[model samples]
Target: MSFLKRPNDFLFRTLVIVASVSLATLSLLVIYSVVMRYVFSDAPDFVEPIALLLVIVIAMFGAALKVREGGHIGLDSLVNKLPPRGQLVATAFQHGCLIVFAIALFFGCLQMVEATMEDRIPIIGLPESLRYCVPVIASVCIAMFSLENLLALFAQKQK
Candidate 1:
């Protein structure tokens, strides 16, 4: 009866671990840099890129988990008062909106990546590819979340 034995539980825990590690490592690095900067009067040039990369990585992994856990911003107060069938309908509609948002974001991200190929960050001069990969990952996460939600909704109806 371990929760992680369930497939969804396993996936959810894996995602949570990954996101937590990414953010924690970033936090530690930032703290170390700050300590060095104050104590030794110097810091490495790579901190900014590393920090930004950590932010993107954490956000990409965390987004799907947030959606799966129903942690995303929502108008749930109104829907909460509805009857069971009405709630299901509302959920279906809400998931439909999520699907559309994901699709639009996916396309928009593609356009951005295409337009920014020649551009580069000023400080790190990292390739635009590195920066724009975030949107691509985010779009995929959002799509996955929407699919999972719909599946859950369907299964709920059967029960």
Candidate 2:
């Protein structure tokens, strides 16, 4: 468990850092874009596409981080009322659902990435698949965290 904890902690911390940096970059980009548009009347053409990518990074990474922290919405009040075994089952079910959803998201995003590989983002000229790649990475993280939680739940049950 300690060994698993170390890697999981590292992953969680990395996600948090990535999300924080993305958010800061997105904020600064928005401010710069606004100032350029309003004051200089010469907004950069690349700003919109770059900002869109940054937003995807912030949102997907943030959601993955929330899963690791157990900060996402859950029916805790309802689960708490159940017996210990029932609570365990409910928790396992929740984690299972997250794992399943993350897997589906990953596959779906992969298909999107493949389908859009030849298309370029309008202003940035980068492959349009770049946008979907963010979700693919985030979904892997989400699946890992959910699996970790699910295993921990079963381990606790055994104890």
lDDT of 1 at 49: 82
Question: Per model, how many backbone clashes are there?
Answer: 0, 0
What is the C-alpha local distance difference test score of each model?
0.77, 0.90
Question: Per-residue alpha-carbon lDDT of model 2 for 22-80, expressed as tens digits?
Answer: 88998999999999999999988888889989989989998898888877778999999
Q: Give the per-residue Cα lDDT of candidate 1 at 65.
A: 76
Clash pairs, candidate 1, are none
Pairs in steric clash, model 2: none
Number of the top-ranking candidate, with TM-score as the measure: 2
Model 1 lDDT, residue 37, Cα: 91
lDDT of 1 by residue, 1-159 (tens): 233226556667777887899889999989989988998989978888879888887887687678777777677998899998888888888888877888887888788888888888767887766766776766666666677778778877898
- lDDT value, candidate 2, whole model: 0.90
The lowest-lDDT stretch of 10 consecutive residues in candidate 1 is 1-10
Q: What TM-score, over all chains together, does every model reach?
A: 0.82, 0.93
